[model samples]
Target chain A: MLPLSVPFIATAVLSVLGYVVARKRALSVAGGDIRTLTSLPHQHGLNTALSTLLPPLAVMMVWAIGARIAARSDVALVPENPTMVYIILIGLAVTGFVLSLLRISTSFRARTASEGWIMGLLIFASTIAVLTTVGIVLSMVSETLNFFGQYDFRDFFFSTTWSPNFRGDSDLGIIPLIWGTLYISFIALVFAVPVGLFAAVYLSEYAGPRLRSVAKPLIEILAGIPTIVYGLFALVTVGPLLRDYFAEPMGLGQSASSVMTAGLVMGIMLIPFVSSLSDDIINAVPQAMRDGSLGLGATKSETIRKVVVPAALPGIVGAVLLAASRAIGETMIVVLGAGAAARLSLNPFEAMTTVTVKIVSQLTGDTDFGSPETLVAFALGLTLFVITLGLNVMALFIVRRYREQYE
Target chain B: MTDYKISAKGVQVYYGDNHAIKDVDVQIEDKTVTAFIGPSGCGKSTFLRTLNRMNDTIDICRVEGDIRIDGEDIYDPAVDPVQLRAKVGMVFQKPNPFPKSIYDNVAYGPKIHGLARNKSDLDEIVEKSLRKAALWNEAKDRLDAPGTGLSGGQQQRLCIARAIATAPEVLLMDEPCSALDPIATAQVEELIDELRQSYSVVIVTHSMQQAARVSQKTAFFHLGNLVEYGETDKIFTNPEDPRTESYISGRIG
Candidate 1:
């Protein structure tokens, strides 16, 4: 078949040609009195261009997807002759161009017609966004179902041990990974929530204009640093530092890569997520509220703690929950700082592995697609998806309820 | 009790080099309704804020000279603004009730001041303040409802109740009736008249008629200067200054 660029270039050239031809046709039909036409010349041109590209692009996309599906089947890779598909695609483009060229008339409202097509394009773009999420969930669910078919659902979910082996009958219990995900996320939140909240309160309330302007973006710069960089910081710096100074000396595990190390680094990474959003929420509690409290004999700190903070509590809870969801989905920092040991231990300083790390490990490298090990990644992914989805919904509900309180 | 509840001597207020309130003097008397009448931007509100040190909140605002309330200098470094504010209560134009129960809104000041040693005492203070604000009968049944749930007039009265819960020696109302309807304005005027018996009530009003109706003594301020200060009857009938007469007759603002 012709390369993808061939059809793209052909469509672009044809669209430009269609624009010029249709504009000239419209002007001529208007008898050089542009006001006589129902729609302007530019509208006629845009309508022709949209019509010119639509047919060929749609045909090419459909043919590409059909060929991909056909190639996946137990048949030859050519999939019903790629040459015929290219010819038909080009044929449709030419037919669309010729039809549009004949349709540009003086009385026609090309503006309204083209606007309808643009609106359709916008709706289609939004549909693609929603369909992508649906597609991801479907793919994961199918694989997870296959995984449960091969392995007992109870053992996969409820069993405490997680031992994946090349020998087929691996103890694929998700409990250990689930525990590690929660434990690390808990520690991350415990470290993050208070520090982030205090920073938000101080910045939004106490910091003067000049100080706030300088400090706010500087704190947000921490968020701009990618999580992968945080992983490296965790790996090379924080892990060894914690092991030598805190963990090993306190009779905890001697491993450089432990749950404590990963949790602390991840917590630092999540500070901006909490503080920026909480700052906005705190700032939204009206200036009148602060004045009322202060006018009633309450000091600045008392006003903030008793009045402003209480008014902003619902939004702060929502922000904390969103941060919690992010902490659960975090992968890079855990893989580097938390060692790959799926042990069910009470100690936080011991090496542990999370669901995300195991999902990456099981999916990477050469492995049979039919094996339960590879399919378990989908199960882990679906569980994580469900958890984060639950958290997001709760946050949205709380924020919505908070809005109605003031409005 | 002293004849003058609050006295300002050559008070000058500057907001970042812009002289908002020029050097002026006025004496507000005890157990009387004193009204500051002026056009917009005439520094009536700024001068009222100086009494309670509310001007301290604005970083650019600077108050010079001395303002004595009940024989004590409020701006002295030793005086805590919080304690002074409790002694001198303020009600704003907009009804800003805390997003809490009506009872809690009134009890807020008393609780912070440790005025009530027990829950029943706090409850008594809230009731008495609401009663003084003429909101007791209406709000007594639903004291647990959010203060913000009240109507605009009721909310303004709730704020007044909240302000008086601390049992202040002086109460300052900055255009308290400006946002109310005609009926609500009448009700608040009557409340202000009653408030004069217990606390020295200082009100800043834009309406000349309101000053004539509610004030015992009226101070007409023009362009940051006290144009005329006398009994409300004489100020309305025959003002001393031309600017005061023009402002009263609706000539120049």
Candidate 2:
């Protein structure tokens, strides 16, 4: 890993050089009358500085990655594993590129030169981001295809069996895992939707300005609390509470690690997410609708129920879908709260497993590279990615349609 | 007069420290159009909103004294403002149409009050309301389309239709033609004339010409006080107040 000092130094040097060169060019273009320029001279300076720094930094990243790969192969051949040497070399490459950018900046200008280089660098940076996403998808797809070649596709999808042991005999059907995930998520949604939506409506429509000021920040603070903290809260506090109150009383399985426990905790974790999103969309509904309803002699609550809520329906649907996606992809709460048993059962008090939990289990600790158990995590990840992507696309379409109605 | 539909007795309104409406009293005659003409900040609209209890929506506003609708005190604690508003509807300065189908927009009030027993009753109410607003022919084919998709004039008429669907005994219009073009204004003025035959109509306007053309009685307000109130022809031709004369002659707004 490159020391963090490099990029900062490079950026600082490039910024100064960019300022000087941009000023000189601007002054010359305006026949020494600086006031004639349309924009501030500093904006031009920023533009030039960005151009100088971006290209070299990109090239340095590629060079460092290539060096590491080459070193990995060479280290494999050597008697001693030269991991430190590879790291040092990669670090040097990054430092050198950063220093080079620092030394040569936009101040070092040729009068004949155009801004083609800057544009190219910007395009190159953006393409790298797109290429990285595509690369991840491609890598996941290829690995998943390899896993399917060993396991039947129908069995992987439809079969309820999912015992992926590294021992000679192993079954890795994903149905039970998918079922557990959907069940837990469904429970979470049931808890989240009403409470979140009610809180949102209260905050947006009914709360006085002072109460809203206090309540909104308090809710946002829930969002700021890390998921890991929520997981621990679920595991230590809520889990036992549920086992005592719900599971034991109902004559269900008396375990703290139940789907019900995890789901309820996860719902609490997602309250801020749902409330914040729903609040924004509800606020976006024009005040005119409220006034119109009120003018027609409707009570405030009646106006909200009849006019505001209906107008904000599409956006609220979008918010719910997004919350559903968050609940599905959440890993820490389920891992810490729900037990590691992959069973398809209707009983909420029973221990259940989710896809994210299985992914963590499969990846962590030592394991044989060629085993199907190891590869299943990648397949699970690919499926999760696809599901979230589909939901987001649908949400975007709905939100766009809702916005077009008013605009 | 015994024919008066609404009577205000020493009604006063205050916004925080600013007294928005001074001690003012007026009686609106039944089944006639009464126009209140004044410049901006003259409290013409404020006085009009008092009849339907619309000012109660504002948090800091306080209304003092009595306002009676058909000889019943509307401000009585036992009386519900919702029911009062249903009987006395209002149209705002700008055209505010609900984001619903044109038919649904007109049908909303009737549906809320349970006035229609069936689909046919609702259809009848919608048709009659639209026809009364003089918007039926233009909007007859597109009843299912969104109400906001109409032209400005049509949207204003749609709001008028929505107001009339509740079968209000009195209609309060706050500068109904201010946002509309001249032709739309003319259409609305004609509709106002037609409407006065059935329901008491009160309009707050800045146009003296509109007051002359449509109203049976005209009240001129200046700086939150009623300066003159009489028959429209007499107020326009021979006013007793100097402020009214200055305003009518365009010497003062």
Candidate 3:
């Protein structure tokens, strides 16, 4: 079996050769009068190269996938016969090159044919993305079904206690984890929304161009910082500060890692997501709207409140929903700032564990794949997926409905 | 001089060092329709915006010299531009109605200015403003409908109604009928003639025929200077300036 690089190099060299040969043939057919040909020489060359490239690459991909699937069933024959695979791929490429070369005539529409190939490639790339999402959901669904089969669905969903043991009597109720997730996300949104919205308004409406140019990218830099860095900041800074300053003094809790700590840090991480998107949405509200309000003797703040903000309300709602989904799915900050205690409590300062944090802890160490303890991660993940998906769909609906309101 | 509702003396406007409006002086009278006619970028709109201090919203734009509305310097630091704009309402080149109900669009100005004492007062103001703009018949039944849902002509009238609801002493229309059809243009021209009975109406128009039809007094501006200013009939018939006559005759804009 030859190395993978051999076929790749061969395909590249063959494609270049095919391009040059096809271009020369096209020019000769035109007899130096380039306008007589339907498509340009370069387009004919590109069509020939694409014909040599796409079909053999598609066949190789299919062969590789087939071999991978067959390998799981102990059928090693296909994977071991790489020589034959290479020969067939190379033979197909050469055949395509020669066939397309013959078709490059004075009247042949090579440009349209190459464009069709590019369109097909784009569609194929998008299909891979869509199919990957489908595959993830299917896998999670099957594992969740396994979890429900082992444990009663009602107990998994309804029971209040969550205590997993190695001896098989495990109370894996999802309510407490869901409660922690929602509670933390709620706190994050409560802290982030007004601050982010104000920042967006100031940047879009009030700030001069020079200030906006400097401030907007600086605010967006918050989004570029890794979430794990935010987690560390949560663990080292915000957690201790909240524990000593508020939680312990107010008789809430003594622990440094609490829901408030994680929520505050996550909110900091989500400010850019809200501000950048809201800024763009606010800016999209037409300048004419502002002029109309201002020309009617409304002050700047009054105009923003009564006219501009209302016009951009639907888009702002969508941005907030998107940020909410991000908050709900956040895991790194929760794992570090919020302690691993899946307790159903209303006190924000109390130590809590979210669905994402529990998903990480439940599957990290040694565990049987068939056990409900390990399979429960998939259930939690599926629930989170559905929640975020619902939020995204709602956001899309709001944005689309808002678009029809204006010209 | 006391009869002039708006008076500008040696007014100059600059947009980031581009002298948009050069040294210009004009006196606009009360209860009369004064039309500013010129080709595009002739500073007609810029000079109109100065009347209500609307150009104050633009950061790069700077206005110098005196622009007084009813003997009060509008650009004075002591005067609030918000209050000034309420006294002098403006309509734009395009129909820019708020994305709101027809009732709300008209009521918005009066509501913000505290001109209405109660719901009935606000309702009366909206009805009167709509009737004045000639939009009451088409819009009265659908007061709750979105203002943007109206036709282009109706939307322009709605904007005019919005501007009039504040009960401004001076109405500045910047090509208000440019976006309208010929029929709508005629309707708006008729409405403008009626508007002159109460408020000092200043309009910037591109069509010379429109200037002749709607204006009592016409001011021809060329290259940011007032080329001619007189009665509408005299300006259209025998303009003193060659540039004004050429512009009126459709030769050099």
Candidate 4:
């Protein structure tokens, strides 16, 4: 750790010393008159510090990547000595600091020089974020391609069965998983949308300030709870309640774990997402719109229903779509409440499992990476990613269009 | 007072701890344009909202005094604010058309009040209201277009049309021309003059010249008090309260 941190600490200390020493040199160059200089002393100091840090950082980054790749390929990178690498890095920092200090004359545009380095740093930071997302998608794509190479693509997509045995000649179809995903998500949305929207309306339009201030944060607290806890809730309380009261009495099914259990629990999990976002969107509808409606003799409810809600409809739809994507991607609640049985059935009380649940079950515990079952998780992930991506884009489009209409 | 179209006596308005409107009394006549001219924060808009009980919507706002429309106490427990607002319509400082088609914007008031018996009747009411508002010619072709797609001036007229579609007896306008350009302002002023032939039009304006041009009666407010009330010409020309004179001559706001 000391050997690793040594170069970084040296670079930092040198940059600080460069800043103070360069500022003094700049003042001396201007004959102690700041007004005679093209840039302020602080700007000259910043230029020196950035120049001291940037070159060594870039070299270190390149060296680290080279070392990683070389290790993977069973070869040592150039500049094999660790001390030699540290020497090169610290030398570069010293050279850059001295060169910038000498260049900080009375006519030097130090501000622009510092600004360019800062902009480059910002660009590097943003590029890391973008690269991470791109890297994830690329990895998924590679594994999915490997999956398709071994398993017949036609059977994986078109066949309804999803039985994966460790022995050969096992079926690895995705249709039933996709069906379960959609069915559960649909039931969740059906149960959540109206209840959430009505809650949003009550919070935004009818609830008094005291009630709103108390109730809003309490509802948002649901969003803060972990999905695993909600899974427990589904397992312990709602699943048994539904099975004993409704499913057994109606002769639908006797199983405690069913699609309805997971769907209803997922709906409970999603209520805060829908209601909170819808509340904000409804609140954003200008008070002037409500006043216009009310001034024309429309009742408060009438004003909300006819004018305010219509104006906020696009944003609410966007919110619902976002919640739908979340429901589709959910894993833990379905794992506990809906037993892992991939089946395509219209009866919601039947045991079922979603794509996310299967992906977890496929990849967890002892699993060889060479097998189709293991790689299929990546395929399921990529499919779910694409679906959610499409939904997010559509949601953004609607929300943006709504913003333009009002603003 | 009974003969007046609308009457207010000793009206006081408060928003939480802030006294927005002090003791004030004024009577508005039927089929006449009455202008309330004052500087900003003088409570002209607040008083206008009280005529239709629009202040009831503000949770912190409280109104005290006698305000009557057509010899009926509008603040009475038996008088529903929704029904009272239908009888006494209002146009806002900024034109706020419902985010709907032009035809739907005008039809909303009549639809909720159940004034139209059928489609043709609703169409006639919309057409008549648009024509009355002087928006018929420009908006006729694009009745299906969004009301927000119109220019600022056309949106104001659309609001006026929406207000009068309920066939209200009084129209309260809070600085209707403040957001319009000069040409649009002139058109709205001309439309206001025509609207006075049917409904009692009460306008609150910051511009004294607009008050003189469009109103038959003028009431000047200063520091939440009614300084003077009489004919528009007398209020503008003759000797009156010093504050009213200062406001008119641009010596003081």
Candidate 5:
């Protein structure tokens, strides 16, 4: 059996015990009437659970780190087969933690301990989640810093060449990847925004009840389809069709794996995202506004073009931004459809690679942690995170402003 | 020939299977204020909407028989509802100003109909329409402010201004005073009376006193049918129909 960490096991035990005690105390205080308590007994129990678990979890983490460091120091004295010795020490430490948990569980009244124990456990659980995110950010930042130490920051930012193989000399600049990402996303947006907005306008304003019921669900089903399925379709169906029909006949390119191929597939993936959001924002435009416009002799389309869209402009912008973010972060379609050769070109017929593709390539299969190649993935990840976060923040701001205007 | 601006004959309206308005016939004279007074769901608003074809917006709503503005059959296949509405404008029950500047709100219809050739002409029409609605003096300084920023009464007047900017021959008002305070209602009522000097006005009102105050002619609807329609003085004091007397007395609405 895989041994569990001692602190995690102890936290679970203390939390349960603390909860029982807190519940009993709260119920007794309420004269055994559960409803008489200010809050639900479960909330009181949770408060106690969080208090109990947090303190011991913090102590355990510090102890575990110190123990590992001391073990490494002791292994340094042995001078012979340090790696094997370190692995053995880690195994011993894990076993000791499991044994400690087993001993703690066997004790009596363990299910009715202090209320602080339950509160501690809850707090510890939340901290674990928050700390995990912080840990990921720190790890990515540190590795990215290491990558920047080797490659010039200016070259990474501005240079448009990206051929990164572990030969004696390899160029690894980020601009080509950024360009590919932006180009595919731009193509996707161009295809999505108008079609989606029109569909949204039609569905919200023009469609009768029967048509709306059928069309709205059908559009949502587009979003429900798996991204990998889209990837496969792009690879097998669209790729060959483009090659035979357009590329070969026009003499645009020799190969099927092209930016246009991936972009078209990505655009199809983003249609429902744009449509659904645009539908919601359009629906949010008050009925009174439509009535007012229509009442004034404006036809339905004219009303939509003049008043409805303008009223919902900020919301539409927010929807497009959200869709743009989704398009940028899309990975599988680009991975399968767009060939991984990060060449900066305006031609959609040419093959391109994105930051996501590079990150995937760097991390997959056998990866050497010490190498600059693997570390570069961390930098790409950080960049992807920042880009998506900025897009989301801007979308939120626009949506909020739109709502404030109406309210 | 009768100096009528709008005429309806055997007009029946249905929302899905439910008949909202029964067979109703009414004639509105040129440059006169006509009031439709009835209880809620008695189809006063529905009948008012039929004049401008505003009911076309509702997918479930269906209108049968004839409604004409200036002798032109509004429901005819060749007759564009947009153009018909351009000639016979409407103001809704609630104050629904577009989320636009006051000038733009008034200029919207004129711009859509291409009534103005240039900016100065559009400005002149806007100022004239606003003045006619009796809102120009209050809103003169803030023509650029959002129409929605105005008070409830001012917003209704702004809507009236918006309607008049198109220079429509007839204006249909479905409870223009419903959302306003007494002072605002009085102002709108006064404006409605003054509007009779130029445009034929059809107003749907819930208050008997308001119909008496603003309208020259009043039509009383009961259930979904027009029970009585005549001069405002005759309907209020000595009505021919028993339903009209009961409605006016507040016995049955």
Candidate 6:
């Protein structure tokens, strides 16, 4: 609630002042003899600045979080006193500044102190990112536990039907949503992997420089177009086209908003992901491998198929797995193209809904926060996160293994 | 009247706008070890590549005039380079074994060309080729091991075995012993001496001593031209060309 800019600006000015004071003090203490000091003047300056800034920043973050937690608790240990907190934080900063200024002598190893603080800052940055991810997972897990408390865990996981009722007797089975997600993702991969891989081979192996420069960018343009635009395209164009020409005429279900529509649109969206990654991997396979095969009386096609492709296969598989992970977490395209019907059907032409779509629907309106219906969204999110996380880990392992073999 | 296994007439090679090999004519004899020695950028490698049509893989490279093998025009429109390559096998300076097992690397050419009717036949060919390259004892037990896992010399010998497995009439080696240790080089040199009894072997070497030791015929190339071509002893002992004398005596490359 305290305007954060004021303290931030003050801290920055204090750091600059601290640096100038430390550098001048070190110089005077050394009697301008640079060789006699244990560390350089700049090291002293950096050490002073880090000491002046870091402690106050840490206290400010901790105090804010402590205030929030105390407000939530039955006993408010940290009283609602932002002004007092600000005063204490500034006092701590002033103390750090005085102590570090006093410590800047010729014999003191200020370089290590400065470097240690820099390392601490870097570690803090990385920990913030890691802790944010952990925090998200923890939040999702707690909400999901709450959901299971209200809804039977067995029915939520096992039952085939997903009929969520706001009247508290809901059949919130995850099976139907999972099936839709996997089936759509399967269809998309079946359409994408071969087409995308072949496009990669062609671009990497056959295309001339002129053609590749134009074509590669054009393929990447598909990646640059937002998923929302792709969703709209799916809703407007591909869904109806499939329903009329192929699905309905063949006596399949006549719904325009079918899994087939969403799957195909998603596949088109993922082509660049598969192709570009595979292209880089295939190109990375050394030209020496190809030359060796060709030198042994193998034709161009034979060399590529038996040698280059096999060598690049592991990296290509890794790219496909990463693309598969991306396809699983995809949401907007499913929302618009596949209708909002959480049904357990095998027919690609029939309308189906994924877990992400259900999550969005469950959380939209004036919903009770404690109700099982809204809580189910967290469970769905946690499930999706775990599934994608496993796929990503596997992909990374395969790519690292492949690189080790060649390198 | 013609005992030559290969012949070239007015062979000129161009890379894009630059003429790489200029007006070269050479007749390579059958069942003899011939050596081409030159400094770097001398087009000795380029002229050797023309014999097997390996230069065709380069987009900018162009070759003119006739190159014939066994008195047959290899550059004829009717000839397929794939089949031509089966007749003429090549080994590169760096040992580039395919990323397959040792057995598979040797079996690649024979399998593609249908040289074997069964697995045993293929295995026999692999064994015989390995033995011929003097690599049988070291690599016999680990034929299933990846070809790239072998030492530099063993890998080069494996490549030689791979080339010989197809039973090519001619072998082209572009500095085969350059990447090997002296011991491996001696082993390969001995193998090359034995190979001269069967296939027409043409080697391009930077080492003058290696050229003298292995070859019966030697060709010295300078710039983009063949400066001298004669018996190895004559090229070394009494050179008609001053450039050849200067090259052999380490005066100028």
Worst 10 residues of 1 chain B by lDDT: B1-10
Q: Cα lDDT for residue B168, model 5? A: 88
Tell me candidate 5's TM-score on chain B: 0.98
Which residue pairs in model 3 clash with each other?
none
- lDDT tens digits, residue span A123-214, model 4: 76786788679769977998899999999889988988999986767788889999999999999999999989999999999999999999
Global Cα lDDT for candidate 4: 0.92
Number of the top DockQ candidate: 3
- Could you give the CAPRI-style class of model 2? medium
Task: State residue A352's C-alpha deviation in candidate 2, in Å.
Answer: 1.0
The segments of candidate 3 whose C-alpha lies over 4 angstroms from its true place after superposition are A1-13, A27-37, A60-91
Q: Compose the digit string of candidate 6's lDDT tens values, residues A185-286.
A: 998899999889999989988898899999999999999999999899999999999999999899997899999999999999999999999999889988
Q: Using TM-score, rank the candidates from best to worst.
A: 3, 4, 1, 6, 2, 5
TM-score against truth, every candidate: 0.92, 0.87, 0.95, 0.94, 0.84, 0.91
Tell me which of candidates 2 and 6 scores higher on lDDT.
6
Model with the higher DockQ, candidate 4 or 6 = 4
lDDT string, candidate 6, B63-85, tens digits: 99889999989889898988989
Model 5 regions more than 4 Å off:
A1-133
Candidate 5 lDDT over A251-325, as tens digits, reads 888777778888899888888988898899889888888888887788888899999999999899999999999
Measured with C-alpha atoms, the lDDT of residue A393 in candidate 4 is 99
Question: By TM-score, how accurate is candidate 3?
Answer: 0.95
lDDT per residue (tens digit) for residues A178-226 in model 1 = 9999999999999999999999999988889999999999999999998
Q: State in Å the error of residue B140, model 6.
A: 3.2
| Candidate 3 local lDDT, A1-407, one digit each (tens) | 34556776787788888899999999999999899999999999989888888777777666665665566567664656778878888998899799999998999999999998788678767867886797699779988998889999999889998898867999999899999999999999998999899999999999999999999999999999989999999999999999999998999989899999999999998899999999999999989899999999999999999998899999999999999999999999998999899999989898899999888988998888889989999999999999999999999999998776755
TM-score of 6: 0.91
Comparing chain B with the reference, what is the TM-score for each candidate?
0.98, 0.99, 0.99, 0.98, 0.98, 0.99
- 10 residues in a row with least lDDT, candidate 4 chain B: B1-10
Task: Please tell me which predicted candidate would have the highest TM-score against the true structure.
Answer: 3
For model 6 the local lDDT of residue B80 reads 91
Lowest summed lDDT window (length 10), candidate 3 chain B: B1-10
DockQ of 2: 0.54
Error of 6 at A183 (Å): 0.8
